[model samples]
Target: MSYEQAIAALNDQWSQGDMDSDEYALERERLDYERGEMMSAQDAPEVAA
Candidate 1:
């Protein structure tokens, strides 16, 4: 799965209480940063490569 998709699934898991708070927060942070980078790259085409 794509990073965003995986992140979203993790979020769902967290919401469902399937993951602990600490693990959820950490994974959420990782995914949030990754999603930010992905968005930034999308906005700035030169960074995509």
Candidate 2:
């Protein structure tokens, strides 16, 4: 999912308290890592197929 979508989901999860602080932190970190990976992939130069 996109970062915005992930953030929205995280907000909802946070509001629901479905996750503890540690869980929330880990999930957020995972989302951020995913987002960064996506960004890096997007920034990479594409090779001709």
Candidate 3:
């Protein structure tokens, strides 16, 4: 599955109270930051290798 899909699934799990709050928050934050970076890179102009 895609990162976005996986994150959404994780979020659902958290919402269902199956995961610890602190751990969920930390993981969600990490995923969000990484997702943001991926989005940023996608928006950036490509440079020749």
How badly does each model clash, as a count of residue pairs? Answer: 0, 0, 0
Candidate 3 whole-model C-alpha lDDT, 0 to 1 = 0.83
Comparing 1 with 3 on TM-score, the higher-scoring candidate is 3
- Candidate numbers sorted by lDDT from highest down: 1, 2, 3
What do the candidate models score in CA lDDT, each in turn? 0.86, 0.84, 0.83
What C-alpha lDDT, on a 0 to 100 scale, does residue 29 get in candidate 2?
96
Candidate 1 weakest ten by summed lDDT: 40-49
Off by over 4 Å in 2: 45-49
Give lDDT tens digits, candidate 2, residues 4-33: 998899989999988899989998999999
In model 2, pairs of residues that clash are: none
Q: Model 1, 1-49: lDDT tens per residue?
A: 7886887799899889899989988988888798889889889978765
TM-score of each: 0.59, 0.77, 0.63
lDDT of 3 by residue, 1-49 (tens): 6787979899899989989989898888888898877777788748323
The predicted structure with the larger lDDT, 1 or 2, is 1
Candidate topping lDDT: 1
